[model samples]
Target: MQNFDYCTPTRLLFGQGVVEKLPEVMSRYGKKILLTYGGGSIKKMGLYDMVKELLKEFTIVELSGIQPNPKYDPSVLEGVKLCKENDIDVILSVGGGSVLDCSKAIAAGAKYDGDPWDLISYKVKAQAALPIVDIITLAATGSEYDCGGVISRTATNDKIGYVDPLLYPVVSFLDPTYTFTVSAKQTAAGCADAMNHIMEQYFCEDSTILNDGFMEAGLKSLMVNAKKCIEDPEDYTARAEMMLTCTYGCNGIYSLGNSPTGWPLHGMEHVLSAYYDITHGVGLAIITPRWMKHVLSEKTVDRFVKYGVHVFGIDSHQDPFTIANQAIEATYKFFESIHIPMHLKEVGIDESRIDEMAKHVADNEGLENAWVPLLRQDIAEIFRASL
Candidate 1:
């Protein structure tokens, strides 16, 4: 185990009808609220009315139409403007991870005088930020439990994961009932996203057995429950488990004593999502197995063997290389079985921009420092294989 310091201060009110506690939670942060959501899905599901009725005593400002990838220009800028102009005391993000992610930027930017991009890009550090509370409707990204979010600059084709301790949500209301209406496509993609989070930590250079066991169980649970979710979106038990799994995904808990892998799959997929505006989790699903194959070698075969045997129940009697290859194939097939588009071309990406994305990922994401360091050529090859 490695030395570490960790804290997750977000108060979680989990289970059905938990959003009814919104009024009591919001009271601690004052009455002026910036309500953030995406695409009006909350309204369609009647969650908007439920939240509004609960918080009827409070003043509210709406920042709607936040996208999946969560753009910086309109969403972040408009949110910041609302916060500053209204003296917003707290932000209530009432949608998926992207809304909460945009709210994080807005929360920080509300305190800063300069452009929010500087803070998001790490050009400037945040000293203070507005308090954030969220009702997560999607199981992906895990932004509600983490102090980080991926933000995209569409014009520049740049997507950056921004993290600051101050960005953690003050409160997160997790009612799995809200996710009961999630589509099969998103449920599968969300599973892929959360699973990749574990693999990112599991494949590291140094780790404790405790963490490895936790990740292995998490991977298995996600794979099993993700299929359940696809078969029946209303399975409360499966939805709750998957939601909790995703909540733990990106908060550094799984990687506490582990050496960093630099999250190379995310590094590669960020370019795909940023360039083509594809779904974030879908892009991750497409890239993960390809990256796994590219990075496989003698040094990494042991990890793959353990993953195959423990997570997939692959027979352990086989040679290490065959086990590793089987594990990679199983991963690909799992995503495919869950209905994620398994190829970049299927998602409208082609060779024309492979070189561009590889170069961009190399220059920006620093994949060369990943666990199995990847050069631009290596990343390009993985991209081609994914295609």
Candidate 2:
């Protein structure tokens, strides 16, 4: 096992009516709130009204319409302006991971006088950030439990993962009821995203047996519960378990004392989402199996064998390569079974930009340090295979 330093400070209130404590949680921060959310889904689900009614006494400054693959240009910039102008004390992000991700960037930017991109791009490290309290409406990304967020700059077609411990939400309200109304497509995509999060950590060079068991169980649980969610969106037990599993996805707890895997699939998929504006989770699903196929070799087949035998319950008494290949096929089929568009072309991405996207990922994503050590040509080949 690898040596590590870890801490998860985000206070979680998870269950069926946790939002009832929203007012009490907000009281610890301040009265002036910078409320951030994506489009109108919150209002449609009546969460917006409930939040307003709960915090009627607070002075709210709204920064609505934070998009997925959260934009750094307008959303982060505008949010900083709102915080500065209004002297916002705390940020209330009441949507999915995208909203919370955007709010995290906004939180850091509000404290710094320089451009937010400086902080996001790591040109400048953040010293402090305004407190963030979130009500998670989706189970993907696990941004509520972690300090990292992926921000996109469309002008340059750049999507960067900005991580700083200062940006962890002070409190996260995770009520599974909030996700009961999630659409089938989104629920599948969210499941795909959370699964990839575990896979990224699981496929590393070194890890504990205990960590592998945790990830294997997480993958199995997500698959079973995701199907149940598709069959019945309001299955409380399924949603609750899926939500809790996902909350641990990106927080590093699942991989404690484990060697870093370089998160190579995320590096490749970030370019897809950055260039095509495709769904983040869908991009991951399309890239994951292909990446797995590309990276499988004598050195890595044992891990795949274990994954296949443990997670998918494939017969382990076969050739190791056969087990590895079977595991990859099973991953692809699961996403397909969930009705995710399992091809680059299915999501409006095509071969035209494949080379360019591949080069960008190769240059910027540091895939050379990945578990499989992919170079430019290797990345391009994986992209073509994914197509």
Candidate 3:
């Protein structure tokens, strides 16, 4: 086991109808609330009205249209303005992880006078940030449990995973009922996103047995229940388990005391999403199998074998390489089975920006830290393979 220090300060209220607890949770922070959400889906689902009715006593300053792969431009700038002008005491982010992640940035930007880009770029540390309370509607990202957000700078095609323990939410409300209305496409993509979160941690060179087993169970659960939810959207048992698995993903808890594998999949996918605004999970699904193929060698084949037998139930009688290759094929098939786009062209990403994206990822994402270190040419080749 690796030496580590861990802490999760966010208070979770999870279950059906737990969203009604928002007022009680927000009351502690003060009345002026900066309410943030994405698009108008929440309104269409009647969640907007529900939240409004629930928070009738508090003044709500709304920030809407925070896009997927959340942007730092208008939302953060506008939020900072709202916080200053309204004297907002707290941030209440409702809807998916993007909204919550955007709100996390807003919460920090609200307290800082300098350009918020500094914080996102890690040019400086966050001194303090507004208290954040979130109501999650998406099972992916795990931003609710973790103190981090991935924000995009459109001009630079930079998607950064900005993390700061100072930005941990004061409260997070998770009700699986909220995810009941999520579309099948997004539901599957979300499952893929969460699963990749575990794979990134589990595939690390320095992992312990404890985290590998925990993550294996998580992967199997996601695979089984994701299919169930896809086959029957209203299956509570499947939805609940999928939601819980996603909740634990990307939070570092699944691999607590486990060593880091450098999160190379994320490094590669960040470029796809950052450059083309592709869906994070779908990009991950497209790149993961190809990345596994590229990185497989004597040093990494054993981990692949374990993943095959443990996660895929591959029989051990076959040669390890054969078993490993089958496992990668199965992964691609699983994502395809879920109707997720499995190729870069399928996602509308082509060769136009591959070289640029490869260079950008190499420069900024630290892909070299990967278990099997990937250089710029290696990243470019992986992108080409996905193409």
Top-lDDT candidate index: 2
Instruction: Assess every candidate by TM-score.
Output: 0.99, 0.99, 0.98
lDDT of model number 2: 0.94
Which candidate, 2 or 3, would have the higher lDDT against the true structure? 2
Q: Which pairs, if any, clash in model 1? A: none
Candidate 1 wrong stretches, greater than 4 Å: none
Q: What would the per-residue lDDT of candidate 3 be over residues 138-171, giving only the tens digit for each residue?
A: 8888999999998888888888899999888888
The CA-based lDDT of model 1 is what? 0.93
> Which digits, one per residue and each the tens of the lDDT, describe model 2 over residues 192-230?
999999999999889899999999999999999999999
Give per-residue CA lDDT, model 1, range 1-387, as digits (tens): 778889999888899988888899999999999999999689999999999999999999999999999999899999999999999999999999999999999999999999999999999999999999999999987899999998999999999999999999999999998999999999988998999888888998898889988999999999999999889999999999999999999999887978888999999999999999999889999988988888889899999999899889999999999999999999999999998999889989999999999999999999889999999999999999989
Model 3: colliding residue pairs: 204-261
Give the Cα-based TM-score of candidate 2 against the true structure: 0.99
Candidate 2: deviation at residue 132, Å? Answer: 0.4
Task: Give stretches of model 2 more than 4 Å off.
Answer: none
